[model samples]
Target: MENLDGNIDLKIKEISQKLKELRLSRGYTSYETFAFENELNRVQYWRIESGQNITLKTLIKVLEIHQISLGEFFKDL
Candidate 1:
């Protein structure tokens, strides 16, 4: 929650938590390492996990890295 104030929305928080869980489930214990290994900007990836922002392209890239399809990502949303 660094750099983020109290203005985040509930849905955003849910998505953030989901993404974090996804990373953990994928066997990544540290977000920094994951981002670095995946060639993503560590701060940008952290912001996405923090529910700050994420473009569709970024989402697709992340899902690809996780071996998850778009349907699967949006399945429970």
Candidate 2:
């Protein structure tokens, strides 16, 4: 069970990293610019991408901004 908890944490961090990569790949070189153009809170998005913490709603909002469905986001995971 403890291992399961650790695995969840690791996965969360991986998701965070992927979010950052996605932004970069989409030509948003700066996280701030991405957040601004997407009308998101810059600091909050930064936290999400930094693996600090994030909520499902926030994640959904980000994906929606990118026109990415949750299914597409998780397809390769």
Candidate 3:
């Protein structure tokens, strides 16, 4: 896993915005609901969605829950 050392802050903002939009579009009422539906721990998912610093492994997992493959996740960036 890359340690998320470069552009970490920028990436956080970008990912946070995208996650917020995706959650709203999915009609998810809260982080708990979203996490449950996505098979993630609610607290961990909340942290990621809020752009708090996290491990790359967790980041990849969250992206997967969002149905974003590694390739697709980076193509736009």
Best by TM-score: 2
Point out the higher-scoring one by TM-score: 1 or 2. Answer: 2
- TM-score order, best first, reads 2, 1, 3
| RMSD per model, one decimal | 5.2, 1.1, 4.3
Better of 2 and 3 by lDDT: 2
**What is the Å distance of residue 23 in model 2 from its true position?**
0.4
Ranking by lDDT: 2, 1, 3
State the TM-score for model 2.
Answer: 0.91
Per-model clash counts, in order, read 0, 0, 0
Tell me the deviation in Å of residue 7 in model 2: 0.4
Looking at model 3, the pairs that clash are: none
The Cα local distance difference test for each model comes to 0.85, 0.90, 0.77
* Candidate 1: segments with Cα more than 4 A from true spot: 1-8
lDDT of 3 by residue, 1-77 (tens): 25666577888778777777768777886889888988889888888777887787987877776687877777666
TM for candidate 1 is 0.81
Q: How well is each residue in 1-77 modelled by candidate 1, as lDDT tens digits?
A: 84354444666777678889999998999999999999999999999898876788988898899888989877897
**Model 2 over residues 1-77: C-alpha lDDT tens digits?**
99998988889998899899899989999999999989999999889998877888998998887789999999877
Backbone clashes, candidate 1: 0
| Clash total of candidate 2 | 0
